[model samples]
Target: MTDENGWDMSASAWVIAQGENGDFTRQFVLDPVIDAWLAGRSFASALDVGCGEGRFCRRLKARHGIVAVTGIDPTEPLLATARAKDPAGDYRLASAENLPFEDHRFDLTVSYLTLIDIPDIERAIAEMARVTAPGGTLLIANLNPFITASGGTAWVKDDSGAKRFVKVDRYLQEHSDWQAWRGIRILNHHRPLSRYMTLLLAAGLRLTRFDEPPAIGGPTEARAAYNRVPYAHVMEWTKA
Candidate 1:
């Protein structure tokens, strides 16, 4: 499963499952924070690392007026879908650990829900920082360390079989977890919150923004549950 073939096999199903924007959590919670971060901060060039299907890249152009937005991923099947969806855009088959671009190539770079899937996140962060121009921004949206460290999204069932409370455990150890949905299966690695922040600092990126935004415009019951503890975390950093 470490190889890219699994994603190729799951490509069609992944596209179908994601629809035009993204999954339930992404659309309802994460996107708003990401959108707010990008708001009024247009860049000349932007890069999306591990950009599955290039949805955000297209948004960068249409919404933020970024003149050039390039998306790169190790999975060819996902890149194919991105190219098919946006014929005029630049989509490359590449890995975040080894970006195919010169240093300081982009004014802004993003890794949306992608870092958890990468095995060598330190290397990827180094490359991301390398490609971002000095004073440039690098934004990352991820499953909250608290959520992923718990292994999976789970809830405790009471006598009546209702979800009484969410379960969160293993916050101190780093590990991997598997997820499957609609014929799409993938592996995700988890690390504590301190590790992620430490990596960004070690990569010479300064943290500017951190947030755990609540789900917005979704089912009331679900939103109420998420309001207790958000499942997503967004971080904004600047190359210094």
Candidate 2:
């Protein structure tokens, strides 16, 4: 691996996993909620933190009509892939804890499924807030705290090989765990929901909306499994 996070080494696998459509949670669960949140909204400039392969950055322009979109990631391989895919797009190699743009540069700043990947959650949240213009929104999509707290032991199955119930422990504890699947290995951090809320509020962001969205489309089995536990959530915070 080229980096400690393993994302540099797993970049290709990550891209493959997110093929034309995103993985199950993104396509069926998170996308619908994000679409609804962005309905009738328009932005002149947007920043996507931890934008692997620039998928959401493209979605901002192609689907939502955002004029200028800049994506940043710490992994160079992913940024290279994103740049190759969208030559005209701005994909920078940068970390969320230290954004390279001027203060209050973007009207819409987003962190989609990325908070878990950041080692310094407080610093990352502060940097994200710093770059967001006044009256702008910071949209976040993330795995639920319960789900992350499970730390890869998310389900307990019976002898019949059926899921009995989700398993969550140490809900209030903050930690990191290694996740390996589909040729991708990476570290994911887990923090209590209150940790995230406290950081956002401390950054002077007002919570505008929050939702534990249900899956709208995917394989029947996967959709059913997701709805049972609702593994992800979305939040919208605004800078007043």
Q: Give TM per candidate.
A: 0.94, 0.98
Candidate 1 lDDT by residue in tens digits, 1-240: 355436777888988988897877888898888888888876999999999988888888888999799999888888888999999999998888899999999989999999898889889999999999999999999888778876676667889987788787888899988777799878888999888888899999998999888888778887888887778889899999
Highest lDDT model number: 2
Estimate, for each residue in 1-240, the C-alpha lDDT of model 2 and write its tens digit. 458888988999999999866899989999988998998998989999999998999899888999799999999999998898889999998999999999999999999999999999999999999999999999999999998998988999999989999988999999999999999999999999999999999999999999999998889999899889998999999998
TM-score of model 2 relative to the true fold? 0.98
lDDT of 2: 0.94
Question: In candidate 1, where is summed lDDT lowest over 10 consecutive residues?
Answer: 1-10
- In model 2, the number of clashes is 0
TM-score of 1: 0.94
The reply for model 2, stretches above 4 Å from the true place, is none
Cα error, candidate 1, residue 97 (Å): 0.8
Residue 221 Cα positional deviation in candidate 2, in Å, after optimal superposition: 0.3
In candidate 1, position 221 carries an lDDT of: 82
